[model samples]
Target: MRSRSAPPTVRDVAARAGVSPGTVSKALNGTGQLRAATRDRVAAAAEELGFRPNHLAKSLLEGRTYTVGILTSDSFGRFTTPVMVGIEDALGAGRMSTLLCDGRGDPLRERHYVQELLNRRVDGLVVTGRRPDPRPSLGRLPIPVVYVLVQSDDPEDLSLTYDDVQGAALATEHLVASGRKRFAHVSGPERHWSTQRRREGVGRALEAADLPLAPELVLLGQWSEAWGRTAAAQLLRRDSGVDAVVCGSDQIARGVADGLREAGADVPGRVAVVGFDNWDVMVEAARPPLTTVDPNLTALGQHAATRLMDAIDGKELPRGVHRQPCDLVVRQSSV
Candidate 1:
């Protein structure tokens, strides 16, 4: 029988390439200073020898776990899933793994999870929440911390949040340009930053069009479809002259459209409707494809990861809220 061959080691590759083990390590781990020619040689030798570094041993030497921590207010939320996918894809491309923790919207639990991540010596941290608030304690952590889909408490902290103001402006402008003068708004939770920004954008757009926002036409409620239905019914009952309805979210828009249809109103023909948060699959599958704002949640996650990675590499990122742009996806709902 043939003798079993021993697994290749970093030492074998370094020797074969005529370079020190340290140089080979630096080239493989994407760290340290090594000449291009030497790095290439080591890489070629490693491939030939089938050398794979022991990750545990490497972590021990570098004092880095090569793991990132992600904390979300609600892991099962529709918006959180796609954003997490984007974050994971970006981090995986960098050869990093993630440890996810769900806070369930509890501040105490969030604080506890942060401490646990720190204790594990995570390479970086990502925090996701609906509300934007200053995070003074995060700055004290030794590793980099990034806020995603939320604003940080401190103005100087790094964050990646959706451009709700721009999204709402685009939606409202589209309606105004299309000759819809009498506009109404169906909003989400009053306390949400996204809700406030979106409402502000709509208000600004209406003001620019020289049309005052009719207070009776504005309806504020939760982010649920039920709330949208109720609000839409109430608005229609109270204001029969409204030509359009701007929704804070796609889910709310869906409800509004349903309510209108039930009331014998033809969407886009009688009353045009627009909403934020693209929600492609869900919104696209609707009978009348919904016109909504694509918040680019995936891009938001990827940008946050990139920023955190740069900070880890000793790069200086400009501090403050980093707003990612939103695109309006036109569909049948808005015509």
Candidate 2:
């Protein structure tokens, strides 16, 4: 019998089962070809004793921690939240755990978290971000690293992200297919990588359709409902003939809808509105839901996690950026 304060051990289970410690060990591990009856007895004894195997010991013996660290700039950001869920899904399927650290977009804080994770000897690391820009690399580490939702400055590192350009193109094409010839684009800050890519995508689609996204028709501003309202109003004032407006985000789309309604323009009948980031809150809440682009961010996280696991398992890790495709969600706004 073990002490009341101490956890039951293999020896205790062996004693309770009337078997040798070595036999108990073999039976517990399903090794040594023990008789079925003896194995059953050992297992029953272990269960009665509430004996829990030490996973840390097993991991040490196997030369693996079976744990990975997730380092993110914005831990609770809308985009990163879904990505983290996808990562957890993949890691759970593999019976692995995660240590999450938020950097809050501060370089010093990020460096501190990285050091802490490394100190804990995480098997691998997943670096994620709030935006899809090239982030500073964590430099060389002893273990494999994977970047999610953003690529590292180092081209040799592995990264998984969505195709922003294609996403925008999909939105623009949807509007064009709806017989909307006159188009206007309103999006977030001009300096954002995603904004630039989305703008380029809309332009490319318009060019392919032999349509023009004239200078006055493009409005690059803050990513807010207020900006959306202001931009939509200005767009309408400048070109009341605009048949469709493509917004950079769902929030912006909501504002644009309000602007159009205020201007006595019928949504989808007189001015179709499309948005990016199929965010449920803004899309579903709008008077007449929104048609938006789904970036498949969760899938990107899953891919990144699986790729990191593969590297941990001694599989060859591919280098450079890997892009996942985005899909469109059709709703009343676009139709």
Q: Which stretches of candidate 1 lie over 4 Å from their true place?
A: 1-6, 14-23, 30-50, 131-139
What would the per-residue lDDT of candidate 1 be over residues 1-335, giving only the tens digit for each residue?
Answer: 32348788887888899988888888998788888888889999999988888989978987789899999886566777778888888898888899999988787888899999989999999988654433433555778888888777776677778778888999999999888988999988887777888999999999998987888888889987888889878978998877799999888998898888888778988889997888876588754788999888888888888888888778976677888878989999877
Candidate 2 C-alpha lDDT tens digits along 14-93: 89999998898789777798899999999999999999978788788888888899998876588889999999999989
Each model's lDDT: 0.84, 0.91
Winning candidate number (lDDT): 2
State each candidate's clash count. 3, 0
Q: Give the C-alpha lDDT of model 2.
A: 0.91
